[model samples]
Target: MPVTQAPITPTYADSPPGPPVLELTGISKRFNGIHALNDVGLTIRAGEVMALIGENGAGKSTMVKTLTGIYQPDAGSILLDGKPVVLKSPQEAMQAGITAVHQETVMFDELSVAENIYVGRQPTRAGGRIDWRRIEQEAEALFARLEVALPVRARVKDLSVAQRHFVEIARALSQEARVVIMDEPTAALSQREIRELYRIIAQLKAAGTAVIFISHKFDEIFEVADRYTVLRDGRFVADGALSAITEAELVALMVGRAVNDAYPKAQAEIGGPLLEVDKLCHSTEFDQVSFTLRRGEILGFYGLVGAGRSEVMQAIFGMTPGVTGNVRLEGKPVAISTPSQAIAHGIAYVPEDRQHHGAHLTMPIQQNISLPILSKIGFFLRGHRAHETQIARHFAEQLELKASHLTQHVSELSGGNQQKVVLGKWLATDPKVIILDEPTKGIDIGSKAAVHRFISELVTRGLSVILVSSELPEVLGLADRVVVMQHGHVRRVFERGEATPEIVVAAASGIELESARQEENAA
Candidate 1:
C-alpha cells in the first residue's frame, strides 16, 4: 500500500520555542567591499523549522555558505546553544553536526546509492577493509525511516530528481546532524512528493532536530515552518513566528513591493493552428500523443513526472531518436529530424534542463543569444559582434533580463537570470511556435511572474506557445487548453473554461475518471 499522510497541522504553534540550538549574532560578510550579509542575525531552536525566505540573489546563498563554513564571516560571531564556536571549514562544520542539503544534490553519478550515502565515512571491518554490506544495510534503514524505497546498489545517475533528493537528505542524516539546512528542497518535487517531504520534516522535528528551511515558496513556508525570517537585498528584514505573520506581508518584506496578480495572463486573439502533432510516438518514452497549437494560444501539457510529457516534447523537437509521427507547421507537413530543422521550420524549444541542454554556460550572453542566428548575422563569428550585441540587447530589454551586461558569462548569473538567458536565446530565433518546458523551474516567484507576463506578451504578438509544466497553477492560470496525460497517453483534454484542479488532477492520476466513465456506461 502507498503511504498515506495525515492532515497537516501547525503542531509547533502549541508550544513556545525553547533556547536555540544555533544562533547567528550580528553576522556580516562582504565580497570585495560589497556587503552580502550586513549585521544579520538568526536563531534556530531545537525541534523548530525556521524558514529562511528571500528572492533570488538576496544573499540567502551567502548566509548559507557562512553557516556551513564555506566562507568565514568578515565580522560578528556564531553561537551554538550560547557557546561561541568557529567553523573554519566544511569538515569542521560537519564534525560539529551542522550539515546542508543543497538545492542541487551533489553526488558521484557513477557511484551506487549506498556508496554515495557513505562516501567519506564508510564502515570498515577488521584489517580496515570496507564493509559494503553494512553500507547498504544502513542506507536501507535510512530510507525505511523516511518511508522511501530505492535500490541501494543502483547507480546515482539512474535515480530520478526526487530520489536524488532523498539520497541527499539521507546523507545529511548520516552525518548525525543536529541541524540540517534544506535549501529549496521542494523546487523540483511533485505535489505528492512535496507532501512526503513535509512528513519527513515532521519526523526530523520529532527527533529534536533543528531545521533551517530555505525556500522562495510561501505556501511551503506557512505549511512546514514554525517560525519565519525574511531577507532582502543582502539585509535582514524581519523574523517572527509563522502564526504571527501573513504571506502578503512576507512577500512585501522580501521584494520591497506588493506583487499583484502573479499570473498576468492576457487573453490574445488565437488564430488557426500553427503546429499539429498527429499520433507522435517515441519508443520507451511517450507514445501516441497528438495536439494542436494555434497561433497566439497557450496550450499546456500537464502530467506527473515520468508520464512522458517532456519526452513527447523532445520527440516533437527532434531531440529524441526513433520518433515516429507526423508534424505539420502551418498545415504543411514538415519533417523535423534535428534541432536545426525545427528552428528552420519556425519552432523553438527551451528545454527543461537549461544548464545542460539550453545555454552555453561558459559563453557570454551575447554569443549565446546569437548562436541560432550566427549564420544569419554575418559570414564569420567575429565580424558580427556588433550585430550580435544589437540583437541580444533587443531581447534582453523585451524580456526584462537582469544582468550586468551582455558580455557577462551565463554561468555567473543566478538561476532566474540564466533561465532568462535561455529564453532570450530561443526568442532571438523569432519562431512562430515556442515550446517552453518548465520555463520557470528553480526561479523565484517574482521571476516566475515576469516569465508568465512575457509568455502572455508573446501570444499577444501572434506567437503560439506549448507550455509543459509540473506546476498545476501555472497551467491552469495560463493555458487556453490543457491536455492531461497519463502513461504516455492523452487521457483528457480540458478547455480553459472547463479545467479545474479536481478534474485535471483526477484525469492525470487516472483516478475517478475511469469510475465515472463506468458509472455513465452503466446508466
Candidate 2:
C-alpha cells in the first residue's frame, strides 16, 4: 500500500447547495466491439472546478469527445441546467452553453485576434455587416476580465502559445459558455503562465461558470480543482472532494495500483563521452553552446520557456539551418545537415511538440513505429509485414503502450499513449543517442514512471540521453548533470552532486547566488 505524499491538497469550503449545472448519467460509448466508456457518471455544480482525472487510456478523452458532441454516446443522458439536452454536433453543444478550449488551439492563423474569437458567430448589424467594432471591444473586455493584456488587432499566428490559449478562452466566453472544459491547457505553458491560468480559472468559477479541467499533473489538479472525478479502464472509479483524498489515494484510484515512486532513476554505469558538441551556435536562438554526453549518462537541460533549450537541441539534431557546430561521435567528427543525416549517424530526436512534430497522428500505431526505419526495411514493404510487426511490438511492449490493437490510429489513443507511440518509434531505430524533449509533459503519473524507467534502462544498455524539461523535480531526479540557460545563453552547468532546485532555478532566472540566498532568507 502507498502512503500519503507531501502536502499538495486543495480545500474548498462548503457553499449553498443548488442544482448541478451539468449532469451525465449512465454514459457508454463503444468502438469496434471495445467499450471506450461504460456507465460513466459525473455531476458538477455551477462555480465549481471539477478535475477529470484518469490514466491515459481511462476514457477521459472519450468522455470529453462525447460531451463536446464530437462523438455520440451509445447510451447516456446529458442534462444541462437540470434539463435534458441532446447534442448532435459541436455547434449544438456550443449553442447550448458548453464550449471547450482544446490544447491545440485551432483558429484562422492569418486573422486578427478579435476576428478569430468571433470567427463563426460574429455579431451582425441591421445591414448584416460584421460588427467589427463590437468584436474588438468585447475581446478587450474579456481580456480585462481575465486580467491579461493582449492586443486585439494582433494576428493569431504572431501570438505565443499561452496567448493562443487565451484567445480560445475568450472565444468560449464570447459564446457565453455556461460550462467550460479545459483539456491540458497548461501542458506547454511556463510556470508563470500556469499560475496565470489558475487565476483565470478562479475568475470563471467566481462568475458562476462550471469548469471541467482535465490534466495529468497532480499538483495542478490539487491547486485549481475543487472536486475530483477519477476514471479507470473505461469506468468511473471515484468522485469526491479533493480535500478528502491524498495523492497516493488518488493515484490508486486513477491507475488501480500504487505509484510508489514518481521518479525512479535506475543506476547505470557512467562511461566517458559518447557524443561531444563544441561551440554550437544558432544565431538569434542559442549561441556558443557546448556539451558532452557520456555513454550510459543522462544530461538534463533545464530552462524557462523560450530559453533556447529546444532550439539548441533542434540545431544539434539538424532540424535547424545555419547552425555551426563541431559534433563528434565516439571521437569521430561528423556533419549533420538534415534529420536523415542525423538518423543515419545513429542519433534520434523526440521533439517537444509531439502532436505536430513528433508523431504522425493519422497513421496507425504500427506504421508510425516503423516510420524512422522505412528506408532500412526497404520501401517495397511487400514481404516485410512480419518484420515490421516484430520491431514495432518489441518497442511498444517496452513502453507499455495501451491500445486495442497495433492497427489502431495514433489519433484514436489518448495523449499519453500517443507520446508512448512516438517514443517507441524512435527507440525502434536503435539509436546510440536519444534526445527526449519534454518526454512526460502531459503524461499521467503512472506513465511518467514507465518512461523514466525506460530512460534509465536505455542508459544501462549503453545509449546516451539528453533530457530537456521544464519540470524541476524531473531534472533533479533523472539527470547526471544539469545545464541551465537563459535568453539563449548557457547560464551555468552543475554536476549532480551540486545541483539544488533553488540554485538551478536561480541560475536559469539569471539570479546571482547572493540574491537567491537573500530571497530564501526573506521567505
Candidate 3:
C-alpha cells in the first residue's frame, strides 16, 4: 500500500536548494503476524528538523531501525541523493553519512571521554597506531562545535548523565553526519541542557545537516521542528510544516483521537505521613535530604539527569550504602539495609532502566511477576502456580498487556508490554509506598495512559508514591506535591496547583522562581 504524502504548505524559510538527501519509498516490514510498518515513505531535506510522532507499536521505531540497517525491510527502496543504495549494516549507514543518538546513551564507562567519542574510527598517526594526542584535540573540537564543555581526558563514568548525552552528540557531530536521528534526545536532560541541544540543532541545520527528531514532548516539537510527520498503526497518517498545526491537533494525529485533556489529576485530601525521612544523608550523592510521603499522595522529585533523584530513591529502597538517615514507616523507625528489608517494610522501587534492573526478559511473564515474592512461596516448586497465575492475570488485565499467556517470554513483548510486566511484578508485592523512576519512558500513548490509570488506582487504594520522572507533564499531572532538585539538593517545592513547566524548568536551572515572579510583578 502506498501512503499518500500530504501537500506541504510553504510556510518555513522555503525548502532547501539542494536535492533530497535521503528518501524512503514503499517501506514495508513485518515480524510474525505483526505488520511493524506498512509501505511508509519519507523524504529528508538538507537543513531541516523533521519530527516523528507516534503511539507505541506505531512503527516509528521500526522505520528508523530499517533505515539504519538494524532491520532490513521486507519490501522497500531507499535512495541517497536520488541514487538507490543498500544499507546492509550500521557501518554502512554511518559510512553513508547517517548517524543516530538513541534514547539510551551508548558509551564505555571505563574509557576516557575522547576515546569513547571516537571509538571505532580513531585518528591514526605513523605506523597505524592510534594517535592519543590528536584524538583528544579532535574530541575537544567536536565538543566545542556542539557548545558542550567537558574534560576530554576524564573517564566517562565520572561525568553526569546529561554530560554523557552531550558526549554522544559530540561523537555524532565528529562524523559530520548529513542526516542525524535523535530518539528522545531530551528525555533525560535539564532545561539548560535542552536549550543547549536546541542551539546545537540550529547549528546542525545551519551546516546543512538533516535532523530526524523523535520525542513525545509537544512543546519541544513546536519549538524545534521545522516539519512534522505522524505515524499510527504502522502507517503514515499526516505530515506538514509545524506551523500548519496546533499542539492539540498534532497530539490527535499521533494518537488518532482528540486529547481534550492531557492531565487527569484529581485532588486528594491531606493525611498523616505514611513514610518519613529525617536528615537523610548519603556519602556523596546527596545530604540532609528530608521529606515525607503521605497516604493517597503522589510526591514528585523533579531534577536534571544526575541531580540525585535516582540516588534518593536508592537510599529509600536501601540500595545505597553508608547512608545516615532516620526513616519511619507509620510512625515507627525501621532498620532497612537492603532491598529485602525495604520490601519487607512495604517499599517498592521501579528503577529507571527496566531492561537492566526491572525484569528478566528471557523469563516467562508469570515467573517475572512472582520473582519478587518468591521467598514466601519457595522457589519455582512451591505449588504457587495457581496463585501466581491469578496475580499475573489480574495485572495483565489491569495494565492491558498484550500477550498470548502468562507463560509468554517477556523478551518477545513490546517495550510498553515489558514495562507493564515490571509494574505488575512490583504491584504483586503489595507495597505501602511505590517509587517510580521514568515509569512512562518509551511507552506509547495507550500504554502511558494505562500506567497513569494504574498510578491513580494505587493512590485511591491509599498507597503513597514517590515518582521520579523526566517528563514534566507526568510530574505535574500525577504529583500532589513537587520537589525540584539541582546539583544533588532540593531547590524548591511546589504545591499541586503551583507546579508548571515554566516554574519547574526555572527551578531545575538554578533560578529562583519567586525572584523572577517579583521582577515580573514589578514590571
Winner by TM-score = 3
Writing each residue's lDDT as its tens digit, candidate 2 over 1-523 gives 2322333344445532798999999999987556889999999989999999875567888999999999999998999988999999999999998988888888899999999998888898889999999999999999998889999999999998899999988988888999999998986788999898899999999999999999766778889988998887689877888878766566546534332356677799998988999988887788888888999999999876557999988888898988887999999999999999999999999998889999999999989999999888876867687888888888889899989989899999977788999999998888999999999876666677788888878888888999998766678788899989876888888888666664665576554555346645775
Write model 3 residue lDDT over 65-172, tens digit each, in one string: 887878888888999889998889988988888888887877899999999988998889989999999999999888887777899999998987678877877877
Q: Which 10-residue span in candidate 3 carries the lowest summed lDDT? A: 1-10
Report the Cα lDDT for candidate 1. 0.83
Report the lDDT of model 2 for residue 156. Answer: 93
User: Considering TM-score, which of the candidate structures 1 and 2 is the better prediction for this target?
Assistant: 2
The candidate maximizing lDDT is: 2
Q: After superposition, how far is residue 41 of candidate 1 from its true place, in Å?
A: 22
Candidate 3 overall lDDT versus native: 0.81
Per-model C-alpha lDDT, please? 0.83, 0.84, 0.81
Regions more than 4 Å wrong, model 3: 1-262, 378-383, 512-516, 519-523
Compared with the true structure, what per-residue lDDT tens digits does model 1 show for residues 33-135? 5678899988888888999987555678999999888999999999987889899998888888898887688889999999999998899999999999999
| TM-score against truth, every candidate | 0.57, 0.58, 0.60
**Candidate 2 worst ten-residue window by lDDT:** 1-10
